[model samples]
Target: MMNPAPALPRLAIHYCTGCRWLMRAAWMAQELLTTFEKELGEVALVPGHGGVFRILCDDELLWDRKIDGGFPDIKALKQRVRDRIAPGKALGHSETAAH
Candidate 1:
């Protein structure tokens, strides 16, 4: 019998087309995929409307632009994903440069 495949995190970025946030969404996805190349299963870009911009790791909400009051900067975003998927993982310059 074949062993079951390992479960991996799937990330989704939902950005509003009406608000022209696709480039931002795509860029974030690129950053995440490059950062978590081994830890993640997939990253999906989901088109949305009404100024919605969100990031989800599986079913867990990572960021919501509206409720959070603004978009998350790259550093904050990288830290958020790292915290959820690989706690204690160092983010290199992304973690240290600001300090």
Candidate 2:
């Protein structure tokens, strides 16, 4: 194992309504969280206010990403999370919370 990398950036994903894709997205978020922890230490992938899973990092603005479309929308979601984390880094790592 290697020492954790510098704090690249923070990311937060928010899902508003309860939908089938919501859970799917949550799983995807989990996968991202595990994969990116090396570059972005102490990241958070949490289920937001309304059963909405969110990924929170240093960038507070990222908390506002509300993805409506499911599954296929993951690409966009990943982009947004990547944008929030840092340009070069990837996504997958998250801090989970039930809401």
Q: Identify the leading candidate in terms of TM-score.
A: 1
lDDT string, candidate 2, 16-48, tens digits: 445434565567667556666555554444443
Off by over 4 Å in 2: 1-25, 45-48, 51-54, 63-72, 89-99
**Residues 25-94, candidate 1, lDDT per residue (tens digit)?**
9999999999999889999999999999999999799999998988999889999999999998889989
TM-score of 2: 0.44
**Model 2 collision count:** 19
RMSD of each: 1.2, 9.3
TM-score of each: 0.94, 0.44
Candidate 2: C-alpha RMSD after superposition = 9.3
Q: Give the CA lDDT, 0 to 100, for residue 65 in model 2.
A: 34
Give candidate 1's whole-model lDDT: 0.94
